[model samples]
Target: MKNISRSTALFERAKQFIPGGVNSPVRAFKAVGGNPLFIKKAKGAYLYDEDGNEYVDLINSWGPMILGHAYPAVEEAVREALSCSPSFGAPTAREVEMAELICSMIPSVEKVRMVNSGTEATMSAIRVARGFTGRDKIIKMEGCYHGHGDSFLISAGSGALTFGYPDSPGVTKGTALDTLTVPFNDLNAVELLVEKNAGQIAALILEPVVGNMGCVPPAEGYLEGLRKICSKSGIVLIFDEVMTGFRLSQGGAQQLYNVKPDLTTLGKIIGGGLPVGAYGGKREIMDSVSPAGPIYQAGTLSGNPMAMAAGLAMLKHLKDNPGIYDALNGTANFIIQGLQKQISKYRLSCSINHVGSMFTLFFTDKKVIDFASAKTSDTVLFGKYFQAMLSRGVYLAPSQYEALFLSAAIDKTIADRIIQASNESLEEITK
Candidate 1:
């Protein structure tokens, strides 16, 4: 159970080269108070750490592994693509194939342009929005993570929001001025922002379901209200479905909520565990980018062959098998219900929020509606629970602000194990 020795050794080596011994900030374990586990390999529902400790993984690479780690078809597709080539700055047939599949599957996406990460996808989308509408200001939802770009880095989520510093160091005050942020699921704040900005606002982008604040869904009529307001004022509505896109459903949160966005940003599952991102929606809006239009955005690895092939394989499999969602939802419900039962029985002062395959257990009694409410959760209590769960061979997102993703690879047995671990962990931590 002790991985401290291997993790410490790796951390020492990594800190010398990699900043904070991790590429991503959340992996630093500052909030959880332990060395982050160095995952050697993952398969199906389990992750094997450097010290050979296996655990039921709930993070699922932050919502990408719907079919679980190293899915056979996706892995095979990537391997086959590797035989040909990895990247080509020019066009590839696989990119077209991938785009076609994505557009067909995602209801709102008519013309998807590939990018290297969610940051690029969102950044490009915002640029396109400004170019198409001829406006400078954009509005984003508080506690909603779009990406790491300068514009999105303002009032961001995940690491930035978790640490209570939405405005990052390098992001200038001018960049922050162009981006206005309001609370999640707050339609009034959105309405006021739109009315106040009027013609100056180019677009309003948000996670349809606030995943960064631990899976807080939009209130009833919230998205519909935004849609109406945006349409009325000539403001573009962008759905930052980078986390919920393929994970929520084949058509993503847009289809799930029955709200079509002007622009949509997608990542994670599309890459089939590789690094890839895409932004697409109305052809008119997308046509404003690159050679076809004025705004230019390019990447050497934008449509990498391997990423395309893996994504194609993953999307094709999901499209072919419609039952994947049902299975994933059922598994997620099982875990959430189990955790709720334990919470009720033990009378724990916590709240659980779930949507499809994503869920979070917050250490608070208030309804986690927005960033303000989500902040009420006791971080010290969450840290205790996180450590206990880790000790019980269960892997969770290190930060309480992050969502726990469940994949289809997690069977009944794995779900049961997680539930049992939660019950035990709660008891141990609360005691």
Candidate 2:
């Protein structure tokens, strides 16, 4: 068995300083029931824990390492940039180049502004939408996390079938009132909310491909319906592509689904695993932000040299190799197929939702198209399966609510090992 003595001790020490001994809540492994693995380093497709045990990484640093950990080009770019120092409150040519590249890749974003994280991007986008539309209320899908922004933390309430209730303690009732929450893949609920709020709704935001509620994909007509509704209702549509940005395709979910929104929030792959985010869209909407217009959004480290250099290198690589998406999808499909065979052999009531390089295996027979169905998954069984996989040299997301992100570092050998590990884990958990 892998020795976790060091990791356990580290966690105990972290608890004295950091909340729950983790910077992020899920990393606490509360749902999976164990001391979280404290990774010391990562390379290619694997992570080495502080305990000196190795694991085939499935999280991929929460969907950033598309080209995989320690990518030569990105690493080189960051190293070269380090000699110039880290931050500059003023603008740089790299930021201009990065902005230009993003505009060229995502046509919907005629203009772009860099931020430090996805939460900042989403929050700023919502504020921009409200300022531009002269409306206060916004629509967001249930269980779709746009980060911990106060407005985005609202959940669905009993009234109007779309009324929102504050999910967190700090969120005010007034903030919840301005934010309407509806079920995913349910156009009717969105339509109802828009109709009820009529002319008051400023924007409708969602993950075109949700990863927060475990890789739940949009229904056949869902995106199209949303597009039509927003167009007809004069609501600015925002696609939060933090997870789906580069993972789905070159232009993100907007290009993959061919559904353009008025605004888009992006993170992950763009930073090459660094803290970076961007929100951009129609020229008119973007012009509403800062120096150019009235709405104010600014960041001192928004386009830091190191982050821009790293992101530019990563995006350039991905752009140069359009085939990466195909390869990623093929690998994800292979793993999915293998897992499915194991699921069948075990006679387990499980459901898998996969898209491109992102996937989630839910311990539920019901299809998890929305939060309601996703909640039906057996958490107890999944916890056991998670531990089983971990014990056998595989590392998955600590929470069932998160999706497993595959990296390009995974080769045929790594893929086979992951599948074999899954097979053993399924059998052991079921038995």
Candidate 3:
């Protein structure tokens, strides 16, 4: 077995100080039945753990690191920005340039507001939607995670689902009541909800291409249908692209799917692995934000220079080289195809849902188009498979519910390595 002595010791010590021995619930490896590997550093497509073991990184910082960890351009940008300062807590030319770039890239975003994280972006977007529309309730998809925000905790996914608490305890009943949920890709359910709560719902928010519940893509006309429903009902349409933005394409899922949302909440690749987020959309809706209008949202480090520098470099690179998306998609297809061969060979009851570079290998044969279908996966078997993969130097997301992300750094050789590991892992787990 590979040595994980340092990681095990660190986790034991961490439990005394950190909640559940991790800053994030999923990082504790509770779902996968092993101690988490504490990463010492990552470069390219590999992670070096504190135990000095090496792993082929498949999560890519949970969707950032699209160009891979410590990319030279992003590193240089941060280094240059660090020479000036980290945070000014005031206006900077970088923020303006960032906003302009976002607006130019995302046709729907005429203006944008910077924030510190995806949660902050989603929370602020919903507030702006509510204020602009003069309504109380909002609609979210079941198992679609917006963040840790109170309203978003109801029927959330990701870490919340891994912990078996979709509706978190700390969230108030009022917040729960205001957040209506519908199954993803079910236009009929959404239509019924809109009809039943006509004029009460202010916004309808979802991931255009969901990454939370294992990379489920929208059904035919699903996005267009939702767009029509919201436009007809006068409810704001918000696309939470925290995981898909830039990683899927230069302009995000919206651009890839040919659909536009009134408001878009972006993080992950937007920050280039840094703590940053942004919410932007229609000029009229964005104008409702403070200093220009009434709805109030502020962050002291909204546009941290370090984050802005890193993000700007990353975005510019993506924008200039549009072929990155094609390369990413091709690489992902190759890996998924290889895994499928192994699954068929082993006769494992498994299915993989994929879009662009994000994918999930579910331990169920049932189609994973939504939360309910995603849950049909056998968690116990997945745990075994996960450990098997880890032992072979491949690292994946620790939960059956989370998607695995691939980076540009994963070349054909790395793809072959992952495929070989998956084959061996499947054989071992089956035995």
Best-fitting candidate, scored by TM-score: 3
Q: What are the per-model numbers of colliding residue pairs?
A: 0, 0, 0
Tens digit per residue, CA lDDT, model 1, 1-431: 55557877999999999999999999988888888889899999899988889888999999888899999999999999888877767899999998999999887888999998988899999999999999999999888888788998877778887777888899988989999999888888888988888799999999998888788988999999999999999999999999999888889999899999999999998899899999999999888888898889888889999988888888999999988999999988888888999999889889998889988999999999988888899988899899999999999999989998998889998888999999999889868
Q: How does candidate 3 fare on TM-score?
A: 0.99
- Which of the predicted structures, 2 or 3, would earn the higher lDDT when compared with the native? 3
Q: Assess the local accuracy of residue 427 in candidate 2 as a C-alpha lDDT between 0 and 100.
A: 84
- TM-score of every candidate relative to the true structure: 0.98, 0.97, 0.99
In candidate 2, position 290 carries an lDDT of 91
List where candidate 1 sits over 4 angstroms from the true fold: none
Residue 159 of model 3: what lDDT?
Answer: 88
Give the C-alpha miss distance for residue 403 in model 2, angstroms. 0.9
Residue pairs that clash (backbone atoms under 3 angstroms), model 2? none
The worst-scoring run of ten residues by lDDT in candidate 3 lies at: 244-253
Candidate 3 residue pairs that clash: none
Could you give candidate 3's per-residue lDDT for residues 1-431 as a string of tens digits? 99999999999999999988999888999999979999999999999999899999999999999999999999999999999988888899999999999888889899999999999999999999999999999999999999999999988988888889999988999989999999999999999999999999999999998888788999989999999999999999999999988888878899989999999999988788899999999999999899999999999999998999999999999999999899999999999999999999999999999999999999998999999998899999999999999999999999999999999999999999999999999999999
lDDT tens per residue, model 2, 1-431: 67999999999999999988999777888878989989999999989999889999999999999888899999999999999999879999999999999988887889999999999999999999999999999999888889888898875211111112338778888998898989999999998888999999999999999888788999998999999999999999999999998789889989998999999999988888899999999999999899999999999899989989999999999899999899999999999999999999999989899989999999999999998887788878989999999999999988788889999999888999999999999989987
Looking at candidate 2, what is the lDDT of residue 36?
92
**Residue pairs with clashing backbones, model 1:** none
